[model samples]
Target: MLTTNRLRQQLAQKQTVFGLIASVPAPIMIEVIAYAGFDFVIIDMEHVMINPETVEHMIRVAEQSGITPLVRIAEINAKEILRVLDSGAMGIVIPQVEHKEQVEAVIQAAKYFPIGQRSMNSGRPGIFGRDDLADYMERANHEIMIIPMIETVQGVEQIDEILSVEGIDMILEGAADLSQSYGVPWQTEHTLVRQALDHIQQVATSRQIPYCAIPRQINQYEHWQNKGVHAFVLGDERGIAFRALQSKLAQFPVINTDRSQTEL
Candidate 1:
């Protein structure tokens, strides 16, 4: 499994980090994404309908196939964060973080005592009951990443303060939501939207924090990469499926139901 530190090192080296949003709940889909060569794949719990039991197996499979597994938990809930961290996620991406207090709560719950109050549990991260819980709790806080999504206008306004908060390692910009908040939905190139993004990158760069941008425009990836942005979450599972479907449909002259699965 790719540790968070390893991913951080890769980002520090200015490597173009690639990742996928695994909206599909099947554990087999996770293995496929791993073999498909993404740096990491996030098991999206915020929007995707994935149960805890199924997600655990998916994380295990992704790790087995050599891809780092990240979880975008539903919200800034500590109890939920603890469950996923204990289940052995390489890191976690939290959503809708608008204030410093919310960030603090997330950090306290995601991390263990001495740093935060993450309760001890014998799970996969502790090697399924073999490793000592106390030592594991102490060390787990240092390794697991807690990335907060900076999407709302308020979040953007408080970006600097949020970045300065301890135990937060990364920030993921929610452009669509931010745009909606700005009263210009889906307008990535809107001056206000661009300005907010610029501010985020500038502050993050100055503070030496890793910030991620989900590029909707093709050129934006290169644009941000050149601007010292390392973390890039590339595509969604639905888009990948659509592309594959289109590619397969292009080859077949007619709708051949009997042979469709075979051809695919």
Candidate 2:
């Protein structure tokens, strides 16, 4: 069912919020992420092969578990955006947005009549006709977030114009793709990539748009925090889980010794 966007509310309160990119397509993972105290979760459909049914289930779990669910759509397709929003995702994170027109298209697809020409339906987000239709449309327009990712050099160049779009709720920095766009390919820490990200943050700050940073390095979170950034998407769940598993195994010295001996 539709509810207040807790992530937006936290940002409005100037509270620092943390979230993770859920590459895993499971409702249980969404429940665990919410229970673990994350303010939001970007359910990745851009890279992960999660189907519409699974995506809807994950959103339902997120709602039940008390976390804002945001879906990262593969592109700026109206149908895809409409389907996910109808499934009750609180926000849509459009990937690789490089032009103001792209942002406009997202608005057209995601928002309602006076805002944009989003096709209307009293689906899950509308509480299946439980809520008044007029009231639901007004609430959906206000609560549903339209977030765009600035990943390419072209996107960084057009940062000002992109943020100038009326309905953009927030801006997210994609350091990995930004690095690749700069010809460094995964060198997200490269000086040039860092400079581009800094530029994005500076522009977003000047515009008073919340900039969501993905802290790839250990110290980067504190770095962004010190800079007064209120939102962060701490890497993906798969990497987090892998690291946790590796750390757990490292505690068993006997097992480590046996593995080393077997390799020898």
- Number of the top-ranking candidate, with TM-score as the measure: 2
| CA displacement after TM-score superposition, residue 200 of candidate 1 (Å) | 0.6
How far in Å is the alpha carbon of 262 misplaced in model 2?
16
Tens digit of lDDT per residue, candidate 1, span 41-123? Answer: 88999998888998889988977887778899988777788888877887888788788888888888888788888887777
Q: Per-residue lDDT of 37-97 in model 2, one digit per residue for the tens?
A: 9999999999999899999999999999999999999988999999999999999999999
**Against the true structure, what is each candidate's TM-score?**
0.90, 0.95
C-alpha RMSD for every candidate: 5.1, 3.0
Clashing pairs in 2: none
> Whose lDDT is greatest here?
2
Residue 133 lDDT, candidate 1, scale 0-100: 72
Candidate 1 Cα lDDT to native: 0.82
Clashing pairs in 1: none
Predicted structure 1, TM vs. truth:
0.90
